[model samples]
Target: MRRALAIFFVFISFQVSGQGVLDWWDQLHNYPDAAGPDRSRYINLSPGYLGPNAMIMPSLPNMTIDNEFWVQALGQTHAGNGDKTQNFFLKGNFPLARDRVMLYITSVPYETWEVTPETRDERRMMGLGGKGGNTGDVAYGVIFKVFREKHWLPFNFGFRLHTKTTTGGNLTNARSTDNSLYQWEGNFSKTMIEKEEEKLLLKASLGFVTWQTNKNRLPGGSNHNQNDAPYYGFGVEYLNRSWLLSSDVVGYTGYLGNRDYPHFFRTQVQYRFNRLALRTEYNYGLQSWDWNTFSLGVRYYILELLD
Candidate 1:
């Protein structure tokens, strides 16, 4: 069994998911007194993001869609043990409501098996069939400018609602399988002040989710977790030609769910050249379950292929 587990981990590379997500941490770190997001700072208006970027970004005016694929390898093993794991996530995002709303649908199906080695008899082990999960999530929101202060302080606000796994996933304990948390989440973020190089922010959100088992769809056979989470953000930007770098985070608060509190920290760099733009970010998490991560992504202007 140990031999088999070793082979399985080798077959799946573990370094694919270099960048993870810590949502809304950047906003709360700055503008520590606002509570809304505007226009393009979120998924509703932007193309694709694994983690929150910064408070300064907003959505584009036109509707757009982005296809994102992650090739990740996950497994766990200890000396003289046969425990193993593997998983993957792929999704596409598109905007609606004239680019003010957004939807995301994806699937993650994987196979895993584990074993416990023994000293006396031959090793006895446990293994699950290659059963995984399929998940679908949708969100919608709108943003607008609240006030335009001259030269020093400007305010922006946004409202967003999210529905989780309104569609798919099977029951298993192998990979990225969401058992349909038919829950709703509402969030708001705000920027209270901003200038050419400094900024401040505030944000809040509430979530309610009911997760019923597939075998029993009734009330008692389900689990629900709901909470109100809030945080604040502060940041500064240093401009170098067409490139900019920003850092921000919120401290001392969180959703207090399975993850940890005061969850925050995200830094991003954005560069523009003609009609092309590129972005890269490194995010730090206060949660114990995750490690610091980063990613690089790009956008291109294919006007030659446009209508």
Candidate 2:
């Protein structure tokens, strides 16, 4: 009876935060604005900044850590709006599961390229001391939400501890923003699905992320430091099914170590003929002093990039 109750609570927690509540914090580093679907077979494709909304599905054969399941290879590329430099990523995962216990191993070899005014104005910005960079990491973690289908709002949160355990320019342990720290985030979704689709859908989430407090800042920037901060946001996605368009903004205003205020935004859209999900967003900088960024991403279900 006690075991059944524990399993039951696990289901309820999954429905609430979308995963293990504490695990969601990791998504903030990937893409902060894209609120993802709380379901199986989901993956967010945004490059460097993965928002809490772009989390992966927990129960796939390819996502387990042990030999319980197999792993698949996937690749992606992205171009930034400012710099002509491009970002690239390649990854695979192995799934592990047994009855109510589940775990996953994800390996991502990724690189980020950057160029800013500082690079352009080497003589003026720093008297010939400007520099650009490339950084990547291999992240592995365990994910186990629920063993069954959900009826109420479902939570799909998780944790994937990334060790700069590979080769990269910023692989030094002393680098504040490049090293490592524990990241966490959680999201809950309630569906008002009609037999033929619906009108109202709501998603609420809470997350706490502690970033390296680096004194060095981004180009034309600030918000550099080792901050063990936390933040939260809520969103509402209304689906008409016919058009299949969704518009939602998820943000947090400095909660217990919250770095910035009103952090991320995701203007959402879904396309038919191919079941494509899309997002265009604006990232805000709080008091920390970082350059604001504009981002856009498309969802390709055939490729399983559920962004």
Candidate 3:
């Protein structure tokens, strides 16, 4: 079975050898002036081609209003592709209106990357040439409760509006998109099993996410400069004493066919003691993505900050 699977993958890879995203790559070469502002016009916008923070599908927000701050050390491995990336993610949440509203901000802050010759050559060919370390975009948003759990509905309801800035650097190197992204989603959660020591809850989010794009870069050119798509996420969580476990699948799809659909599965484990928590997370990319990511972090509850 292993041999057959290997052969099958080899055959599939052969079919896409130099197609470079199935003809999209060749099309980029047609415009020799693909540089500066024009760079975003042609390069593949898939998660694999851009920075770790460029195209992210964050999980649904938990409606609890808790003052918290966290930082994570992240590493990404591209396996056979021979690319290594290291970065830090920072996030904080503060209560704005007791249990009704919360404000949050998150950013990749900084990253270092090293790619093999083959990967570098491919990037050079597509106009994203340079490498090394760079900063990532900053995102801020607000989350508010729409309905309290068990108030009128069996589930807790909330809404979130998020916006990403073009604060990231190394655009020519494709480390960032240099474009803005906005997302708004409705969130729902319901507890399924509850005990004195443990409980399970289901969570989901539904909404639209849109980002700036070059219309001419699209196949046959699009009528608009922004690409919009329906984004979604669903997951389950289990909490027992000071431990929390969760798994989720999240993604979004754009109109372009050249690796525009991106999604991934993520699992996280956390242990909390008093006002401090330790966490580790893993993400497996799916659909045109080939990177495996791991992260270790610590979270501190600053409930006294707003208390």
Candidate 4:
């Protein structure tokens, strides 16, 4: 799997050449405290396969729909046990009475392969078994630009509230969608460097997530009692006309006394074109749940529904 991923990365790197069309990082306000003068043109970054973007798992304050609708498709391969997941996301944003207040909705449909030892052995023997598909939980949220950058402060502050529904398939054990979960997050970002065709930004966010476990049953009749945990993340983004690179570290302590805090690092590279983008990402789990993931995604701005 690692060799296949490495080869895939190399192939994509060579297939796309020249400078990127759009500053993929520029669209994210979470990197800098100040939205700057051109904030209106920036769109929110795609949440990737992890759903929300916060530390171990929360959305960042840089969420913006910018009066546009988006559709994205992602193919992800988990390095462990040779599992694979594919996802399709549809989202859009609408402005409220004020520009700082926005409403948005996101939906995901996914398919996954459950690669267990037994399943692998069965595949080797009988050539069949482990695969399932389902529509994942949906999320509806609101974003508030609590405070835009001002002379008194160098950073921008934003808040987000999201409610995720329990409506998804659980045939494979890889789904994170709960019966229902509510999340609240606060984020800040600031631009650290700016040059003619290059820019750097820093972003941080903290959040809490709580959920009901009625639908998430455990094996052996043991109740799946997951404690709510606080999550936080920090990231840096560098953007140039042809290439964009981003890296972030997020961690959270589990509620269960026996579960230690886990940290994860994710890195992404994107080649942007006018109205179109292609990206590849890798995420490494540092502690607690240990796993490596590789993902490739394609995004199209499509068309401007509104100015």
Best by lDDT: 3
> Among all windows of ten consecutive residues in candidate 1, which has the lowest summed lDDT?
45-54
lDDT by residue (260-280, candidate 2, tens digit) is 333444444444344444544
Q: Is candidate 1 or candidate 2 better by lDDT?
A: 2
User: Which candidate number has the best TM-score?
Assistant: 3
lDDT of 3 by residue, 13-79 (tens): 9887744543554454554444334544654444556656677666567665554444334443333
RMSD of 1: 17.0
Poorest 10 consecutive residues by lDDT, candidate 4: 40-49
Shift of residue 245 alpha carbon in model 1, Å:
2.2
lDDT of 1 by residue, 118-163 (tens): 2101110011222222332322233322223332333223333333
Q: List candidate 2 stretches off by more than 4 Å.
A: 1-133, 137-168, 171-176, 212-226, 240-262, 274-307
lDDT of each candidate versus the true structure: 0.32, 0.36, 0.71, 0.55
Tell me the tens digit of each residue's lDDT in model 4 across 123-157.
12111354555567667888787665653567777
* Model 1 / residue 167 / CA error / Å: 5.9
| TM-score: model 2 vs. ground truth | 0.44
